[model samples]
Target: MKVFVYGTLMQNHRANFLLSRQKYIGPGEIYGFSLYKVSNWYPGVVPREGDRVKGEIYELIHEAEKTLTRLDDYEGEGSLYQRILTKAVDQKGEEHEVFVYVYNGTVDEEKYIPYEQQPWRG
Candidate 1:
C-alpha cells in the first residue's frame, strides 16, 4: 500500500522513527493538501492554492496493514485526522493516490506553521 506522510515522518524527523521500522519503498510528495501543527506534532489536510504540504510517500508491504492502522489510531484518525485518499508523488517522480491522515475541523488554523521550521525531539 502507498502512504503519504508529511510532518515528523519526513526523513529523520521524530515520527520517522516509527516509519523506519516498516518497509518503506521510497520518498515523495502530495499536492492539493497542506500540513499543520496539532499540539507538538503535525497533521495535514486538503489544500487551497496558497497552501503546500510537502512530504514523502512510502510503499508498504502488504502484510503491514495492521501496523499502518495502528499509526492511524495513534494519529487520532477519527478526531484530529481523517484518513483520506489523495494524490501523492514518489521519489521516482510518480504520482498516485494514497491514504493520508488529514486534520479535522477541531484544529485552529492560526496555530500551525510549516513542519520544516519546527524543532525536533529525540
Candidate 2:
C-alpha cells in the first residue's frame, strides 16, 4: 500500500529509516487535512474540511508489517497519531488510496501550518 508522509518521513530527516527502502512514488496532496507543528522535529496532521496538506507518497514493500508496526510505535498510534486510509492526488493527477498518519488530538488554532511552509520546520 501507499503511504502519505508530510514530516520527518518525507525526504530527509530523522525517523525516515522506515521509508528508506520503500519506493518513492512522488509528491502528492492529501485533501481535507490540516498540518500543524507537533514539535521541533516533527509535524502532525488532522482531518479538516476545505484544507489540504502536501507530502510525498511511498509504496511499502518488504516486511511491510514490521515497518508499519515500528512506525505505529514511533508515531504513537492511537494516542498522538492514528493511521487512516485517505485519498491523495499525485503529481501526475492520479488519485491513490494511501495510509496516512493523522494527529489524534485537537488542533490548536495557533499551531496551524500554512501550505507555504514546510510542516516540520518549526
Candidate 3:
C-alpha cells in the first residue's frame, strides 16, 4: 500500500521513525486540497478547489497491514483524522492512488499556515 505524507512524516521530520522502513517512491503533490498546520504539531489537508499540497509517497513493502494499523492510531483515524484514498501526482507527472490522513475536526482559520511557508516544521 502507498501513503502520501506532507508533514511530520516527511523526510527528516519527527514522525519519520514510522516511515523509515518503507520504500520512498518520491516527491508527490495532491491537487484540489489545501494543507494547514494544526497547533504547530502536524498538518491537516482539506478539500479546496485549485489548491495543492506537496508531500512524499511511501510504499509499504513487508508489513503493510501492521504498519497501517500503527499509522491509523498515530493519525487518530476515525476521530481527529480520516484515512482516505486519493490521487497524487508524482514529480514525473504520473498519478497514484494513495492513502492520506485528512483532518476531520473543526479547523481554526487563524492557525492555517500558507503554502509558501509549508511542510510544517513541527
The number of the candidate with the highest TM-score is 3
TM-score of 2: 0.92
Candidate 3 per-residue C-alpha lDDT over 64-100 given as tens digits, one digit per residue, 9 for 90 to 100: 9999999999999999999999999898999999999
Q: Is candidate 1 or candidate 2 better by TM-score?
A: 2
lDDT tens digits, residue span 10-37, model 2: 7777767878988889889999988988
User: Model 1, range 22-43, lDDT digits (tens) per residue?
Assistant: 6565656666555555565455
lDDT of each: 0.67, 0.85, 0.87
The Cα error of candidate 2 at residue 10, in Å, is 1.2
Q: How far off is residue 74 in model 1, in Å?
A: 1.3
TM per model? 0.74, 0.92, 0.93
Q: Candidate 3 — which residues are off by over 4 angstroms?
A: none
How many Å off is the CA of 41 in candidate 3? 1.4
Looking at model 2, which ten-residue stretch has the lowest summed lDDT?
113-122
Alpha carbon RMSD to native, model 2: 1.4
Q: List pairs with backbone clashes in candidate 3.
A: none
